[model samples]
Target: MTTTGLLGAALLAGLNVLPVQAAAAPSLPRDGGPAAEVLARQEVLDRLADEITRVPEHERSLVAGYAGHTVDPRHGHLDLYWHGRLPDHVTKVLAAAPTGVTAAVHEASYTLRELRAGRDRLVGAVVRGEAGAVWTSAGPLVDGSALAVGYTPDGGGRHGVATAGEVSARAAAVAGVPVTAVTAAASTAASTRHSDASPWSAGAELTTPGNGWCTSGFGGWRGTTAVLLTASHCGTSGTYRTGAGAVVGTATDSDTGLDTTVIDVNGTPSGKYFDGGWDNGSGYAKRVVGAGRNNVGDLVCASGAMSGIHCSLRITATDVAAEVNGQWRTDLDTATRTDDSTVAVAKGDSGGPVVASVNGGADMQARGIISAGTGNPVVCGSVAAPTTCWDSLRFVPIAPIVSKFGLSLA
Candidate 1:
């Protein structure tokens, strides 16, 4: 397998693939309509869906019949796709779901493993420059229906003669699956500035020695040594400092494929991250209790030095591949603002934390770290320096990073 292929395989088998079970029942609203009920039902359904998909290491074959799943938080049900017979464990979980939660089983034409293999084939073809220079990115659709291939009208600046339909057909031939061509938008790293004190917290601004700025992500331990996480694209090797010029840490290692870097801290590393606006001066901090994977329709929030906290974003896709900063990054996920008029992410938010509310919104479950901004650009009005925000964003899920680096949450 190629390097990208190997990385993708490792990510699929990483710790994040296993879902965490929710410890408590959801707190439904005191008085509301079906919309409110649907929202409340999501909390427990998310956990139950994860339980149904969990596979023991020795029982990896259990996933052979599994295709993909969609958590419809707005519709108050879980959709599971399968081919052939359902796994024994999956059947049990579905039967024991909470009273109010519903599980809808649908027969699928292809399994997730099969779809992933198809995706890898297409990506490998693109990498070798044999699949035409038209595709910017590609991944398996969450619906288990086809491969979602990204292409622009000008064929991503290489194959202008190719139409979207032609590109889709060509890609489908290579992937051995149905293909859905979507408009490809350009993406840029979100790195900029913020200021904070010692015991450096996540979401604070880090000045990369001569390489501009980026935000601090989750804090964890690399073996016995304390470390901070950030975007590898910010500066692979450098003495990172706070916006106040306080020495934060030094980048000791990084995974370019994952766009994550580990910094050996110079001072204390806090488990909390800033949650207020860009100019809030580190007054608000939220605890990071644990890490989890995001599913389609799940709600998540992002905090960046440039854009603060925006929690209305919904997960739109998972396990995607995208080209960012002239490099192909695999296993990326995309999310969009539920409210179209609001900004989801902006420049300088790269390496910041992407989290979901937990413990009644008092704490957060780490989902991923900000990677790049996609879709249309919006004006960033909070900062004096000119920067751009996007209605949608891409992130690198935190579970694989923690598992790959052998790190533990602090």
Candidate 2:
């Protein structure tokens, strides 16, 4: 019914979302870094959870039934894979945490303390005029989660004031099981044994970035070279920095709203991966010894500076909406929705790969860069920051991407 091939599928899987913050990650303590990061992450999420519940039913319904549970205190963050509009949840955030947020809504992250103060102000209004004890009395939605902030319990016995960590632990404990999680991160440490950050494409050592990451997704190859495929939003205008911390190239070309980009990296300092496998990520080379075909239901994966994560897919939808430079244009349409259910993405994961068949399967192929998904949870995992996930995230079909740019893989 749809004109989607192995190459097309990769491009069409729409992977597009602005980052929570453009600021860099702070230096974490080496010994307590892991634990501290996790706890701090929980504190942030706990505050978000409080804020989301304060909005009116119609608005709160945005995050209604989607998954927000599996985020344990260890990970310090909660994530979702959604199937609908990626920007909707952020709108809800603006409503609750108006102060900490900017009206511009550009890419940036927010803190929990800032969220709570704003959340408390609005929640206080939502619950006024009700007769009850201090804990059970009517309060506003501004600090609705405050009911659970410390030990303050509601009169109805539903929820109460608990500490940030306490609320997070409680919510995560009862989340049951989220359908999607970046399960790829769990697997990479086990099988992807080789030092993944070496040798760029063309077998040349790469000029690695301050924080280098790799993934599997190359537009169809030409003769010998395999061209890399990612998101344009990842490059142009300094939105995305390269692995080498250099603005290596612009998005050279991009089909607007498509979330695909073609960056030009040379063979001298390598900058690419071969396929999308979880066990051992593919190696980049200029030779054409491994070109092959792919099929449905393949297990593709990816790697990036944020960390490598991937999963298989059972192709669901095809022929997604596309536009170029704000014009209605169909540049590429090879997006696929795999049933693997891995919300395998975050801020910096963009312009990477949605690879297929790295688990000892068929010839490699690009499923799509990690665009947007319907089921992906909000990375912050807060009640106030209610998350969303659509049925299919996006990717630019590799076939058309390569054709549009006339790129010949080495």
Candidate 3:
């Protein structure tokens, strides 16, 4: 594939041109002092968290009493909250923490299961329109403190309720736990861009049938069929192509609630994905070893065809429910850039691969796909249709998508 359009030129200007080396670590912002320390701590925490959460559910008894967990990268501490005795498996995981990392367990008022039950109740109430328009999103806090409900203060005008206080009260009653209401910004899908090569790989730009564009996600298999993954909001039914006009695939299945879609590829898709800094058209491919869950404080990276690769982002929340394009998308995770000066995600980046470093950054583990974003609107050097970017991002976790679609990583 070749890059010859205006979008290609813009991408070349916006990103740092780097040599594609398969063994090179991903390009992340270089920082010193407190920021550097935080990044270092986050990396160690990420590995430990992965080990702790990777235990199979059937054999993991800790999950029942697991309330939540938080990583204070600034202090190099990982705190696990539980409602009762810490399970032996978790204890073992914590004991194995590498030097310089501190792990501790704390008692919590409720278990994750209980908190999720309450969150589900609140979500159901909102879905049934029983909460009015006051509530926009709801999820449990990472500290197992309370159910956080994102609400619009003036949303109750359409319903009988009036005021943020009333909204919080109603939500708390329904959730059966304490509730914290936060003002939230509306979410928009990050779709629009151009740039992709043949032998299609994740992070390549895909042109939708409507002439719009989105980033292709990881390649996977749906039973015996090879498929490509991308954001469902991109287009539920249509053919997708590369920037050079090579056919990529056609939509085979989609779940709008999760904002995920599977495309029947024209040819077998590769298990590798583009990595490193934006390559000015020449991109590096990194093998995807497997898939993993997203956890708070874990650092991850995103690769968008329009904006290129961005790293040093820390996951702040998980299982977030946000309204995107007028529909409620639950089980979403949100991450924010540690370096505020750079964009974490950009328009036309929708459906791009969001991956966590694995095997010491030698490979990547599929974590999620870019869904929507808000905050810090800035020019994205790409002349792509949507020439903007955001500092924060919301992504659809890969676990549910793989489970619901019966997909296995390619």
Candidate 4:
């Protein structure tokens, strides 16, 4: 387990496939905007994520998982999750590493590959109809180092109780797969209660003719065609609209394979994300510096319609998988708020921009899109110091989407 009590699960999933430079530490603000420590923390994580990706595939695979130090955010090293001894050479490389980032290996029960395969078998059983009327969704939990199979008991009855127990037994039968039960509940999607922008920008909502709302992931251009990035599940047919209800563009190139799409809009996107909603014009004008992967312990933030702007989410797992509308989406990424009090994500937050803030929150790097998150929140404790029950939120990383679509961030 990490110092933050995070679960160590799968590979970087599909996100760590690329190598990129970490953002340089932003200079301290002249007006005391953001703390120097805050800027340093972001830079360290950016460097860490970059260094992790720089490791060769063979060597990197030796790591089952990794997380940042919660107590010391600038510790400049990650706690590696692994089952047994790492090769001497791997240890040496990590120790003598020059990237300003390092890893400390921990003994884990299952390897990343084993855990990933474990969840695959469970999902396969569901698809094959071998585990009927049982699991609603089954996938690997990188942090917990096990497979989570979700089920919703039909009320409180002997038959319902028996079915849940039987499913657990069947899950254990899957060879080489550690099993765990997750309560599955259908969550109501959050909505865009308000928005404001004279012109459309990234993180705005895309409204469908039929009254559907999904967030615009980022603002940019595709060879002079004004375009906006969003979740592919948002549908290829929709009109881009500001929160104030002004039409801006049309949707196209919706690819569920990538879980991303583009919106061909009329005017140029401001190239800014609505960090504080467009109406207030509170945001950072982030440049599409380059594509990067999210690593455990990375301090990240997102802009959604319902949640607006919230941060303090730390990446917990990668190479995650989820079944959306009966179709399994693999190689996704997952994150959870470090402070349980902070909001991780909500429904309709989909397609919102996931960014890493730098330059004292003046700029950012696009990370991914909000895809899915835990459901059935149960409040615990007083409002002043309340705790929420939530697992993790999954995202479709930006690198793969840009690679597949041949688009550039605005």
Rank by TM-score, descending? 1, 3, 4, 2
- Measured on C-alpha atoms, candidate 4 has an lDDT of 0.57
Task: Please provide, for model 2 over 290-364, each residue's C-alpha lDDT reduced to its tens digit, 9 standing for 90 to 100.
Answer: 222112222234433343333433232223222222222221222223433334443334455554332122223
Q: Order the candidates by lDDT, highest first — what do you get?
A: 1, 3, 4, 2
Residues 254-341 of candidate 1 have per-residue lDDT tens digits of 9998999999997667788887677765357878888876777777788888777777678888778788877888888888887754
Candidate scoring better on TM-score of 2 and 3? 3
Q: What tens-digit string does per-residue lDDT give for candidate 4 at 165-252?
A: 6666767687366667666653222325245353455666556545766677776768788778777676667676765677767887
Better of 2 and 3 by lDDT: 3
| Stronger candidate by lDDT (1 vs 3) | 1
Candidate 2 deviant stretches above 4 angstroms = 1-228, 237-247, 268-299, 302-304, 322-342, 376-392
lDDT for position 271 in model 3: 90
The residue ranges of model 4 lying beyond 4 angstroms of the native Cα positions read 1-39, 53-76, 83-93, 97-102, 141-145, 155-168, 184-200, 277-288, 325-327, 375-392
Error of 4 at 269 (Å): 3.6
**lDDT against the true structure, each candidate:** 0.74, 0.31, 0.72, 0.57
Report how far residue 406 has shifted in candidate 1, in Å. Answer: 0.6
- Alpha carbon lDDT at 308, candidate 1: 78
Q: Flag clash pairs in model 1.
A: 190-348, 191-348, 192-348
Tens-digit lDDT track of model 3 for 282-352: 55677888887667777788877767777778888877777786788888888888876577888788899
